[model samples]
Target: MKNLVYIAFLLTFTFGFSQKKTESLKIQNNENAKVHFSDGPALFFTNSDSLILQVHPQAMLIDSLWMNKLIKSPLYDKEQYMLGDDEILVAGLEELPTDLLKARLKYLNSKTPFKIEYNPQLEQVIRTYLQKRKSSLSTIMERARYFFPMFEEHLAKYNIPMELKYLAVIESALNPNARSRVGATGLWQFMYQTGKYYDLEVSSYIDERSDPYRATEAACMYLESLYKMYGDWSMALAAYNSGPGNVSKAIRRSGGSTNYWNIRKYLPNETAAYVPAFYATLYIFEYAKEHNIKSKERAISYYATDTVQVKRQLTFAQINETLNVDIEVLKFLNPQYKLEIIPYIKNKNYILTLPIKDIGNFVSNERLIYAYADLEDTKVEKPLLELIKLDDKITHKVKRGEYLGKIAAKHGVAESNLKKWNNLKSTKLQVGQKLVVYPKNTNPIVTAKVTPIKEDKDETTYYIVKLGDSLWSIAKKFTNVSVQNIKEWNNIWSVNSLKPGIKLKILNLLNDQKK
Candidate 1:
């Protein structure tokens, strides 16, 4: 009886500790946190609406507002969403009948070994496709009109099911230039090493994975190989998402079961979502009309375009100006042109696909187009060092007691962005580590410019310096405060003299902050 009571007491203690840990996670705090997020900072983007700065999300409606602001921010143009990131950001949909879905999936089933099953998670993803993310899906549908035909042609060569093309839909959403956090690229989302194994080249100006035709062929081959190895297309689909090695690991954990659903519990988080997303996408694509979803009309399609060989190196701007074609349209059609330039080589031919209507003019005016170089960009030479020294970047060295959130707040950037740039998995920090900050395009880059601290009629406040607080860092908290000013006001000469809890007088800070 005494032993039972002791065990019960221990269980109660562990459960209470777990509750406390979970509570600490739900509330925002800076100590040893995985994700260092802060609230109520100045604007991060320059061209964004002021409401973005005012928006806060603990409330229900404000949650969507915060996500909308992020999509508009400059970071949206730079940062590519990986699997986990998409699951969070992609919007949701209302629930549908499970029986209807199973019937539809079973009806659409073909040569591919697809398993039509329903779970709450998969249902949620189906909702995301049919309801919440309707606009995004509509846009993707338009792009599919241009890309899907090409994918079908290539995939047919290998005799892989047409359904497998939807895997690319889940991989990159049909964006040929899409790049993942783990360095996957192209419509197929091939990583650097995998792309190389398939003979895709990567250079400063050329990444073959961004080429629609070549990468699609490579993806088909990879999928075929995966299907051969697994024999079951469902497992192959899972294996394709996570490497075969991961599928093997999942198989081992599931006691030699080859079924995806059976071994799904042992698979990686992203791969688990990946298989369902692919099937859910297939369902939506087939029954979109029933769901009242309509594909948006695309400005261009493959049937209306023609490919031509370029003998000379040319920029998209030159082509756009010479042919009177939209530069954005050129970019969309030819995503492999990384720097907006289609490079030519002595031994190899480079092809450019253009609208069929413009091909005749392009052939006639080839000589004039070659000579129409925009020399304005050539006058100034780009320095090697200048690559890192951008107007939008800020360099900061970590100090004691400084974590991700504090630095992000000071510089007006997101902590998640910081983690992305630095490839950090956690919010843990080390003293004296240098961090590079990239602010939103709409926000001014915060630099180390010291201004004169204004006085509020001889009023003063005392600050108890924290562990990582230097004169420079403390000064940043107040406008127009500087390291030199702190020394002058406190009569301190050595920076090393600062210790935690040491009170320092800051002049006119309280009232000066109002202005």
Candidate 2:
């Protein structure tokens, strides 16, 4: 029954007014295309020459039916959100006076290129956000610290309005992995087609639309194109919500009107409410402090993260286990890896983003890390394609000087696997020892020599364990040292034994060599 009433009201708003063609308002192309509002107690609608509407704050306070209408808007709709998702919706906000709202909006209008005017519908939208979505908004605001700098950088690069950052809040609640019912995805809510149009690749292993930096850059380019098409940010936003074709159709249906408000009712329901939600979000974020919308604690900033080109296919689990990084943090940083696996396809460069502190550790122990990942992959029930490509297997004849570690490094296979495959219990090798190997290089044979690790069991060293230290990390520090070897040598059977200040025995492989 309430939905019927809402529909009736929307229809009345859509078709009640007589058609009057007015010249389309074009925002000038300048650094600051500010739109100043006229001062008065009586607020004027855009089409004031034909109709006059007065602000009735006291009457609005008592109008239950009108308030119900406001509640029905998308701004108050929380049906689509999931818990722990970035979309913030606040409640229990104090009532904002009409005059104050007008003043704030006037200031906003003076600062932005978009037409931010005082209308009952817009007022309802803004008030809904302020009154009902406070906590969520605060959370989103806090979360913005992680992403907004990257957003601003890309927006500035494309000369896009920085306020458009709020569009992501409206679209995906700032969640990069957010996907809509209609299949629009990421922080920018791009559809498969639109994402592809902007060079956001979606493959079996990756979805670039969920990558914050890539998606933001694509969104800026897309929005810049939309603005050029319409010469107005409002319409561009509308077109982005729906499409240019829908906006064009709405324009035609509204007797050739170009104003968003004038043709809004002709647009799709979601698109009709889309721009208002954006504007409301913009207003809320801009005056967050004034309204006491305090931001929650922010996570790691985007600048604190860096990406490195992945040389081998690796799972988030492998990375987490190897690097002692939290799995959730890996997912958050590298959301584009669809299967949580970064693929190493030929000629295609895929990257893994990590907190800046992890980059050096990852790079320094990359070869061993890849070896560990390869060993780990062998245990999976259904291993990734790159792992068990039988076609890439090759044979290598072990020379007199060759050992398991040396051959493994040359072929990019795990040293542990060499022992398993050849049924060798020891590191001893014989001349002309034929070994089956799967080289990552995929060349029929690999002759590239790897600098061998000097094996010296005579010299022993003790390593005091540090906080957050794992066997994998500790093993990476020593040449030719495996976690299995560490366990056997130190008689440490479980990870619990790796308490801080505990000293673990290590063989100083290069003790006799000069630095």
Candidate 3:
């Protein structure tokens, strides 16, 4: 009887200790896990082991007891939650379905450098991320191959770490045309002013911020400068995403801890997670094969073209005409030309990228291409000169956000003139719509006097107003009298209307006035 009682007591005490230890382990695991909210999804990280994620509340209980046992194994590394090859020991486990077991094994054997460790606290975060993004590890991997090469090249040129290429993936999924709601544009999402500083020109006809090559070059220069300042790739990437000023301030606030991990707490919430997200993306891309993620089929390949220097201005229309190439094909190859016109100055040259097959054709027709471009320029010049000659009589294309008053002010004509020119009853004008204005005539006035001409006296001429003449319009016609002076001389109350074919007085008019 005494032997039996002692045996029972020993068993109970052992069970209690095991239970207490398991509970303690669970608590420790929860404390180490930190939850992060991202734009697409929430991420959870565990300090004690690899990350464990749940896509929903139901997923929380998904093989929970089995995962708990796996977390305690020696094969799992605490910081990375990576499982060594030999760590598959589980006892007293029920045989799961084949598909379920396969998934579990795949997750466990993932070779990605970044992984979420299994734990209760991380379960909610995982669920949130999965629910919000509806994205899987496979999808992210599939899209990476398309953009990674261009990013790698640019990063290399800047001498930045190849790992930083993942930052572009996070900022924009290699989409060259990505634009943010805040007017941030391009793959790197640079604002207008920032782009200008980096020599990415934005004009009425072209926005270089949308050009992949130029924007990438600008991004590389900016990143290189940031790296020079911080002497750390991670910090440099952080600064690139969220300005150097912010990163500098964050470092200052963190008691001079230049390390991203150390100063992460002081950085903006988005930036704090940005570094980790980049790392996670890198891990996903590098180890995609191990995760059974395959690359998606892309219609276009990046290495199919080579660049050539064009020393003369060339329009896409001209290229199409001379080279017999499609405009879309040209656009695909040379996306940097925003206006579809390479404005190559005398000393400046544009690097025109063309396909390997098309290079010979482009070279063959180079002169014809130049002539075509010159012809186009000449055509543009003629119209402008004609419009100038017509002065206030010509129509103007309404730009975006332009009103009748604004257009009138721009052309140095009254709003009424613009309205009358366009026959517009209202001030509203749609973008690209035309508005007519009689340009200010600048002709020198000649006054006809009935006085007898003395010897050595100059003969004066008087100009008669035509059927369509206003002070502004008349000033524009002559190129002599300014619109202001035209108004002053005529003493017109409102420059809205002027009767044409009226004689105006002028003195000492030269014969070379027509030229």
Top-scoring candidate (TM-score): 2
Q: Which ten residues in a row have the lowest lDDT in candidate 3?
A: 21-30
Q: Against the correct fold, how does model 3 do in TM-score?
A: 0.47
Which stretches of model 3 miss by more than 4 angstroms? 1-147, 196-211, 290-295, 374-515
lDDT of 2 by residue, 1-515 (tens): 32354456546644663353222211112221111112211111122121111222232223323322222223322333222224344422356788888999999999999999988888877877776677778667756877898899899888888899988888887777776767787888889988898888998778999899899999999999999999999999999989999999999999998899999999998888888888899998898888989865435666656779988898775675466555456766787876667999899989998865466557765764675666545433332324334666778998866666567766655554565566664344678989987654332322223234455556877789765556765764555555655655665533334555889887664432111
If both were scored by TM-score, which would come out higher, candidate 2 or candidate 3? 2
Instruction: Report the lDDT of model 3 for residue 484.
Output: 33
Off by over 4 Å in 1: 1-95, 110-112, 118-121, 373-515
Model 3 Cα lDDT, one tens digit per residue, 459-478: 44456764323332343234
Worst 10 residues of 2 by lDDT: 35-44
My TM-score estimates for the predictions, one after another, are 0.57, 0.61, 0.47
What does the lDDT read for residue 3 in candidate 1?
A: 38
Better-scoring candidate (TM-score), 1 or 2: 2
